[model samples]
Target: MIENRKYIVILAFLLIGMVYAAKLFMLQVVDDTYKRRADNNAVKRVMEYPYRGVIYDRNGAKLVYNEPVYDIMVTPREVHLDDTLAFCRLMHLTKEEVITKLAEAKDYSYRKPSAFLKQVSGADFARIQDQLIEFPGFEVVPRTVRGYPHKSFANALGYIGEISPSQLEKMGKDQYSAGDYIGISGLEYQYERFLRGKRGVKYIMVDRHGINKGAFKDGKYDTTAVKGENLVCTIDLNLQQYGERLMNGKIGSIVAIEPATGEILSLVSGPSYDPNILRGREFGKNFSVLQKDSLVPLFNRGIQAMYPPGSTFKLIEALIALQEGVIHPETHIACNRAIINCHGPHSFPDLRSAITNSCNPYFVNTFKRIINQEVNPNTFIDSRIGLTKWREYQLRFGLGRQLGLDIPNEKGGFIPSPEYYDRYYGEGHWKHSTIYSLGIGQGEILVTPLQMANLAATIANRGYYVTPHLIKSIGESGQPLLEYQQKNFVGVEARHFETVVEGMADVVDHGTGQYRAKIPGLQVCGKTGTVQNPHGEDHSGFIAFAPKDNPKIAVAVYVENAGQGARAAASIASLVIEKYMLGEIKRKNIEDYALKGKFVY
Candidate 1:
């Protein structure tokens, strides 16, 4: 029995030894999990960032391109530096900054690579490339920063910056890291997905001191980074630069659109900085200066700043009245100053003449009839019902709501609803008498310059408009977005726009806007508004479209504290039309006046 027990113990011991040997073989050779872990110790995974897409103007002119930059990446665990002070001097960084950055990298991950210094210019990086070898764990990686050759379209193009921790959390660690640059606003933010190309990775072989030897395994596990898709913008580069020059000293915006296509020709928000200022190492300092400026150059007034539409809104009133059969082309209303203040030189103006003359009482009465059509017996209820219907028409014109411009931070200008009035007054407590100022484009009706330009485009298209867009095409396909191709009809008949168009033409020919808005050889149609301002001088505003037969450009210009619309805004719009239509400005005197921002008739 003792001999049998000894043999059983020996057999059991042999079986255990065989199991142990098999497990070791599986871990070391068959299953690559442990082998990969060991390989990670000597291999460094470097991220290869793809270049962001280039931006071109409608005429195929390069607007924005990429400039090569370098980022110094560090692996905390692999760092072997004896003279930290020498390293700081070579990198143009303070010793304290180096210590802080190294500590931050260590806290993030001792073994992982993090950006130690970013956005070093190609010229600067060239000077330090050879010296970088002295610092063991630090290596240079190629990256790109946006380069604006034109240095225009600061607000529309936007700027890029390091992604915030909050953004990183939502984007997920697999897609973005802490130091990744991202589009912050404007078209850059709107088209980031198409602009930010796929990132590739390369497994690099490293020595004991973390100095890169070469590609691991002859670059077998490497990926090639794909470049981002290019963008073809609808902006006319010449027109944009010209508009920027015209609006140099002004504190307003000019938005011009091609009426037929709704393509934004030029969008200028004044007090804008050069797009270059927001790039490179000085970005942080320059951005802080812009933010603190009192004029608020960073605020995109073209689509974000809302202002009272002023008298330019009268065209919509006439259309809505004509649509509802509340007024006809010859319908006459006396210029009754008792009803509302009157300024234009006309009396007992008909519907067409009222628009040409901008007679306040005529529009006030016209809006009254449109709103209080006796839809309800009670005046309060009738006003609410009328406002609801009026607001619907206004909304169809792309007012009181966001136009879905392909840029971030677009504010929808207010078109007061019955509910809005209810909050201000009380439900059913207001009537056309209380809200009559809205009839003249005042009181709570506000619009962005983009909306006003779109409004002009809508009228030029005979009551329909394409949604304005900055991008004409994306990638090599050269196709605009589907939304921009479709027409958004403003619930008004095409015929109603004929009389309004004729009146606008007449206004440019012999009315308030005649002096500044009349462009020779071009049938420029326009309306002028001297918006009342309690704070200071009235805002000057004008909306126009040229060549009454086949209109090309529709523009809206608003110059704050610039008195009458016929002064600065009208002059600017007419100059823009002449420049676009004639390809030159013969009226250099008017251009000079606008450039100087002198609000004189």
Candidate 2:
């Protein structure tokens, strides 16, 4: 009995020893997960950020570039400071700031690296880099920041800043870490994927004191970062600068497009700031100042502001009326000031004469005749049907909706429909006389300066236009964007444009716009508009294209609170057209007048 008990105890002890030895062998030799975990304690993985793409104008002038910068990175688990005060002094930080940053870093991840202090200049980094050895967990990572050589095009070029928490969750942890910078607005936001290049990694061996000894495998495992692709924008830097100068001290916007190709040449929103102010460490403070200013410099008025199209829309009405056969080129309408006010007295004028004279009564009467033309047996239904038809034609001209511009925040100006009227008034309660204000482009008709400029381009092309775009070519291959190359037809016959074109030409020859809009040798077709504003004086607006035979440029100018289109908007348009075509301003007096004029109410 005693011998049997001894054998049983020996076998149990032997089984326990074999189980322990098997487990140790699996952890130390068979599995790599534990080996990687142990190596992480002695190796530091640093990310190498690539240079962002360069932005250039159509003429290859540099718009945006990169400048050297540095970020002080920290690993929370490795932090152990003997003297906190000395470390804070070296980093130019307060003790509280250091404490808060460490807590934040630890919350992100104790094992991973995060930015402690970002966007330090090269000079500032050089001053403290030698002292970084004393701080066990901190190191300097070289990076680049965006720089603007010319400081112009603040709204168009946009700015970049540190990613927010919300953006991080959307991008995910694999693509973006905690401290990455991203494009915030404008072209930067539009082409972020092309502008932001791929990141690389480098593994380095470190000692117990957290000092980098050398590359872990002589740089065999390191990967080089790829630089971002370059962009060739459609904007003409010289023309953009000139337009900005002409619009100084004004509350307005200017959009110029190449009539043939629909390429945006220059887009200007007044009260702009220097883009340089929005870069580097001072971005937040400068941005707050810009936000609080009463002028609202950040608001992009070119594609975002909605204003009544005013008389610049009359050309559309005339074209639609002619296309629907509601009126003829020789159709005569008597101008009755009692029904609708006109600038002066006039008798029955033909379509061309009425357009040149800008007879409000004629247009109102013409609109009534078209709406009341007995298409349907029921008068109410006929009016609705006619207005619906009118709305369709208006939409074809790129009105009443977004024009699909490449830039962001474009507002599709409002164009009321029969349903819109029925919602306000009962279905059968309204008539053409009830909405006669739309005849002169006044009531409930709003348009952005970009849309109006597109309208001018459409007329210059006779019946079709290409989608307006800001990019001419992309990448090293210089491939043109094919989406903007397709033509969008307005569905109007080409013959109807001739009468309107002749009328606009006569408008520059001897009409209300002649005095301010006429160029000496080039034939300019233009229309003037004075949009009524209940708060103040009417806003001035003008749409024009020069050298009518082979048109090069179509432009629209809107001056808020100005009295008449001819006084401010027309002069500005004329000067811009002259400058673009002639390459120099022969009429220095007109330029001076436009610069010094007090048209704002």
Candidate 3:
């Protein structure tokens, strides 16, 4: 009986042992899923970034571009530098400099590739090419840095640079890394999602010499890098360049548009910088220089700046008055500056003349008539409730708010309603006398140079606009945006705009805009404004379109601290027109005088 029990126990023990052995064999020999996961840590697959999109100006002029640069990448953990002296000599740095750079690189991160030398010039790269064979892990990778064929659209084209860790934290870990370049301003910021192409991943294997082997697994797992889609802008390079030249050494902005289509022809913000300075090996140094320039070159004064629309708002008021039936085109108002204590003493024959002279009291009277609903005009918003109706009309013209333009950091110009005054004075406390400055675009009403330019474009189009885009198309052939499809606006009729146009023409003929605006062959209709501000002298403001009949171009120019519109603004805008239409400068003396001209505050 004892022998039988022992035999049974031995058999049981052998069966249990075989079961564990079988399980061990299956896990060790058959299942490799966990082992493969562990192996992944050893082979690091780095992503190779793609080239960014190219930017082109109107007529196929290249604005922003990409130039080849060499980035000296070093994996601190993997790098084996033999002779520090030799390596430093090749890289055009002292031995101690290499050690310092390597220390900094190590401080940043050792597990990943840390760029010790960024944006090495082609000349420097060539000098170090032969010496690179001595370094075990240091390698030269071809990369793209932003380039500019022209000086810049600066505040317009913007710039791109290495992404910071903060940006990575904000963006999360989808595609971008610590060293990726990204669009930082202007159109680039607005359209980054579309402009930045999809990034691809590739599995590369390296040999003993650190030379790249063919793509891992015959490129079956390799993703091809797609070049960014190019953009074609409505900006006419010639016109834009001309406008910049006109405003060179001046402080302000100019925006020009195709009247009928609202396609931007030239958009310039003064104190511009050359985009090339922010690229290449000396980018960091050059950028610092621009940053310290007394004249702000980084500000896009066109879209981002807001100033009192000045006399230009007179045209809008006239049209609004006409549409509301508060004033007829022939409504005569006597302007008596000495007697009635108004801006003018000469009696205007009609509303057309009133607008031409930009008579303050005439429009002030018209505005009061509209606000009180003195005439039986169609009611969209109730004016009897307060000056609410008139305020609504002004707001609809894209004043008092950011037009939601495609550019970055656009300003929302303020519009003060009756309620605004009510906050300070009771609703009935305010009168036409208090807000008369609003009639001539001088009061609290504000608009950006971009918005003012659009005002001209909207009038020329008779209603609809294409959202005032710098880029006309995207990708190949430049596709147009769908939301901006040509569509008419509500509010004012085409007939309402004609009298304002006539008044504007007459202003060029005999009013404050007479000098420097007359073109020998072209009919330029415009309005001039001299703003009253406590801080500084009046700013020069002018909005105009040429060839009165078939308006080809509409423009707005503003020169900050310049007292009169005709002083510099009109001449600069006219010069830009001449450059675009004539294809050559016909008025050199005029341009020279204008360029060298200065206005004291």
Candidate 4:
């Protein structure tokens, strides 16, 4: 019995040894999947960031650039908060501050790592770098934050911000992470891909204490991130700055463009917020403050705010009427107290005189003749071809639809139609007289300030103008606005526009805005508009371009509640033109009159 027991024990020992050997084979040779995963779990990857591209104006002046900032990252699961007091001292905060910050991070997401503090200055980062070792889970990481050296073009340059949940859904999984910066508005948002760099990943080995050891396997599969492409805009920095200064403390917008190329010279929306406010993680709080303001500095009035084009649209109506053979340029209409209730009575005075005077009755009478087949041979319903042709003309001039510009906040202003009339007052129920005020650029017709600027630009270019674009160039891309270089014909022959141009010339020569916008040596042409605002007084607007022969620049300005279009808006426009063309204000007395003296309502 003793001999049998000894043999059984020996057999049990052999069985145990065999099982151990089999397990070893599986771990070392047959299966390495779990061991590989275990090693990977300890590997904490670190990203080496790339520099963002720069922005320059048309004259090669830098507009936007990057500045390095430090972010305090924390892994809550691994937080060794033992020396909380020391950590707070290093980071320029009190013990309670650290605790509150951590609590906020925890509330955001305990599962995902969150930033405890961000936008730490270089000095602040240096103060805490040595002492950061005291905290197990905290580390300083380098990130790029927007630095607007000029702090001028807030609504134009746009701002970079942390991606939101809704934006993430739009970006999809592989494209973006929560902390990644993306353009929120302006040119940045419009060309996000070109401005946003390609993302890269890094492999890192970590220790048991959750500390980074080194690069994993010498970075065999690592990729280097590519920096974003730079953009050189067509904006003339001098004009843009001057325009901003003149429009300060007003509730209005202005847009200026080069007539030949459709390159935007300047675009300003008043009540603007400083782009510097969106620099770092405090963006959430800063944005909240801007959003709550009554003036709404966040709003881009240039392209986003649609207002009645007012008398400015009369040119479009006249062009449409003449192009469709509705009325002769010599067609006559009598104006009286009963007709349009203008400041005074007048005769047809030819198309030139009517345009110069902005005769409401002439337009109202001419508008009815437009839909009359006896005159145009194209009633609103009968031929349909002529009406469609007129609509196409408006679209070509970028009046009825979007202009496909680089700015992200652009809106398509309204343009009425026969079908639209059917919806509003029913089929054929609304006659030409019902919407007759449209001829005077009133009623349902609406346009953005950008569009009105575009109108001035198109007319200045003679027959056609390129679509307005913001950016001028990128790295390999020679120019950012090349796509908008084609001439958009507005159905008016080059020669056919002569009469209108002459009429506009007469306007600055003798019309309401003449006192402010006239230039002695230059043939400046302009139109004034008084767009009715929701508030008490209507908005004053003036659009013009100078030296009519070789038109260098076209500008439009608006002054909110400034009474007549000639009052403040024309004065501002006149000053900008003088500054650009002359490079110096020839008349200091006139400028002082504008600057020191107030406008009489």
Question: Can you write out model 3's per-residue Cα lDDT over 139-198, one digit (the tens) per residue?
Answer: 777788888877857777877877788888887768687778788777777677767787
List where candidate 2 sits over 4 angstroms from the true fold: 1-41, 208-211
Report the error of model 2 at residue 527, Å.
0.9
Instruction: Kindly give the stretch of ten consecutive residues in candidate 1 with the minimal lDDT sum.
Output: 34-43
Q: Which of the numbered candidates is closest to the native, going by highest TM-score?
A: 1
Best to worst by TM-score, what's the order?
1, 2, 3, 4
Worst 10 residues of 3 by lDDT: 374-383
Report how far off residue 133 is in candidate 4 (Å): 1.5
Put the candidates in lDDT order, highest first: 1, 2, 4, 3
lDDT of 4 by residue, 431-509 (tens): 6657767767778877888898899887887778888888777775576555776788887777656677787888889
Provide backbone clash counts, one per model: 0, 0, 1, 1
Candidate 1 Cα RMSD after full superposition onto the native fold (Å): 3.9
Q: Each prediction's Cα lDDT score?
A: 0.90, 0.87, 0.77, 0.78
TM-score of 1: 0.93
State the lDDT of candidate 1 residue by residue for 1-601, as single tens digits.
9999999999999999999999999988899986865654477788889999999999999998999999989889879879988898998889889899999999989988888888888899989998888788888889899999988999999989989999999878887777788899888889998888889999998765456778989999999888889999999999999999988978899999999999999999987989999988899999999999999999999988888988999999999999999999989998999988898577899988888889999999999999999988999999988889999999999998988788888889999888888999988688999999998999988899999999999999998999999999999986987998999999999999999999999999998898888988889989988787879999999999988878999999998888988889999999989989999999878887878876765
lDDT of 1 at 435: 92
Which wins on TM-score, candidate 1 or candidate 4? 1
Model 1, which residues run further than 4 Å from truth? 1-41, 209-212
Q: Residue 469 lDDT in model 4?
A: 88
